[model samples]
Target: MDKILETDGERLLVAVRNLLEAKGLVTTAEITERRAITDAANPGQGARMVAKAWTDPAYRVAMLSDGAKAAEALGIPMRGMPPLGVLENTAELHNLVVCTLCSCYPRAVLGYPPFWFKSAAYRARAVRDPRGLLAEWGTHLPEAMKLRVVDSTADYRWMVLPMRPAGTEGWSEEKLASIVREGDMIGVTIPAA
Candidate 1:
């Protein structure tokens, strides 16, 4: 029989999982179920939250206060996940999120982090030259606008609440959500109607 080689990380993960299962702390089925849930998560869940916040004043207040609870209220499963912080972009201020140390993303809400989000260059540029980075992504802010780069950590994750486009005032929540892309929530691009 041919041997199937496992990398060191994979081997360690298997060892830990076996130990956990042996101790009755978790089951393989539970792990599979959780992985399925995580795999099913997507940016649409976050966009829905953003859309609801834009149209509902109470939800906006809730989201701005506690993002994780706000997401749970919207039927997004946030259990066992780090606290999520929603950064709002205003006329004079823009918020950008980056995991400076590693790819610590809000996967429970926004699904997996994009490849670019996990890059060392992005992490560095997001802090060292945010305006330039945004501009490169076709997000040109006014010179006077304040750009704030927030770091996402294993303890806390972040998402952006982008400003609603001017012409989308009368649009429904579903319509608004359609325009809220992953990059919009990442603050690399603005949502446009």
Candidate 2:
């Protein structure tokens, strides 16, 4: 019989879960439930938050100061995890999230990151050649625009609050949220007007 093998990351994840389960720290049922929670959290959550920020002055302030609290206010469950820092992209600057060491992210907001985000090539180039990388990703900023590459560590997960596109004023929150996709919140792309 040919035995299928798991990838390095899968193996490591299983090992860690096993270690915790053996120590009575966490059970398989709890792990399964957490996985369910993460799976349900897609980029739409981020988009809704962005839409709220675009329309509501008070919620925007709360989200910027306390991302987790703001998310909780919207019924998004976030606990026992590192703080989720919301980075606002303005006309003068752009913000990008990358984990130089590992794939740390706000899973409760952005769901599982894209496959490319976990690649070593992307991790290295996000800091070394951000402009080139963004261009390749179809996000061309103005010449010499200020770009901030935020590293998402285990202590803090970063998400981008993309600037509201022009001509989107007076739009409903659902409409605005529809246009803001996952990559936009990740700062690799801009939402269409």
Candidate 3:
């Protein structure tokens, strides 16, 4: 695999620059710089929605029912024809999302997909027994939270907006985002902090 991916950096850069120049693009350097900035700014966009749901009940309900609309209500746009669905982790049911057929990620809300999430091993095992799979990931939940597995197919991707953790009565958005792990958003675990 390493050999397969071997490349000359200078050649790659020249190719990219040539492509951009051929497209009659202006300020390629500025465009690349802006892309980096936008990527950094985009990852935390969903944190605002999570914080709002933690503070507001109506929004939470809406989020559980209509994930896309709930995000739109919070001013998050869903582009590229990607369908969004929300899975709620409740006291009696812990929801987990898996795309056994293909990786159907909620990139709009969760930014880039994790390496494990894109693996076939996780996708296959998660569907078989989500509780065991989550346990393997070190997310040990109490027996009270019944395990419920959800499948996100190629047509529709899902994201888990976890329940607000205990002792977060008045926590700020930054604090909340700090505890919101990638696994939590992927529905494999809930935020503890």
Candidate 4:
């Protein structure tokens, strides 16, 4: 049989997993089931929460108060995951999220973090020159608006609740959800209606 090479990180992961299984701490079936649940999560789950918050005041309050619970209420699994925090953007304040040390993201809601999100350049620019970073992504905010950059860490994750675009009034939840892109939830871009 041909030899299959693996990176050190990959080898370490395999070793740890094997040890865990050997010790009966976790089973392969359980691991596969958990992986499947995480794999099934997508940006759409976050969009649904944003849409519901846009149309429902109660939901908006709930989402802002407890993001993980709000997601659970919407049938998105949050168990065994770090606590999720929702950053609400307003007319006067804009929120941006970045994992400065690592790519710690709300995977349960936003699925996987984008490649750029994990880049050292992005991590640095987001904190050092947020406005410039936003401009590069075609997201320009007014001069008077305050830009707040929040960091996601292993202990906690964050997602943005972007402001509902104008002219989207009276739109249904599904319609609103359709316009919410992953970038919007990541605070890299604003949703356009």
Off by over 4 Å in 3: 1-43
Candidate 4 ranges with C-alpha deviation above 4 Å = 1-26
Can you list the residue pairs that collide in candidate 2?
A: none
What does candidate 4's lDDT look like per residue over 69-179, in tens digits? 999999999889889999999999999999999899888999988898999989999989999999989888999999999977568789999999999989999999999
Quote each prediction's TM-score.
0.86, 0.85, 0.75, 0.87
**Candidate 2 Cα lDDT to native:** 0.89
How well does candidate 1 score on lDDT at residue 150?
A: 92
| Candidate with maximal TM-score | 4
TM-score of 2: 0.85
Model 4 clash tally, residue pairs: 0
Give model 4's TM-score versus the native structure.
Answer: 0.87
- lDDT tens digits, residue span 42-159, model 1: 9999999999999999999999999999999989998888899999999999999998898888787899999999988899899899988888888899999999999876688899
Residue-by-residue lDDT tens digits, candidate 2, 1-193: 1343344778878888899999999999998897887789889998999999999999999999989898988888887757888999998999999998998877788888889889998899999999999988789999867999998866888889999999998999999999998889888899889
Off by over 4 Å in 1: 1-28
Q: Candidate 2: where are CA atoms >4 Å away? A: 1-28
> How far does residue 67 in candidate 3 sit from its true spot (Å)?
2.1
The lDDT for every candidate, in the order shown, is 0.92, 0.89, 0.76, 0.92
How far is 110's C-alpha from truth in model 3 (Å)?
Answer: 0.7
Sliding window of 10 residues with minimal summed lDDT for model 1:
1-10
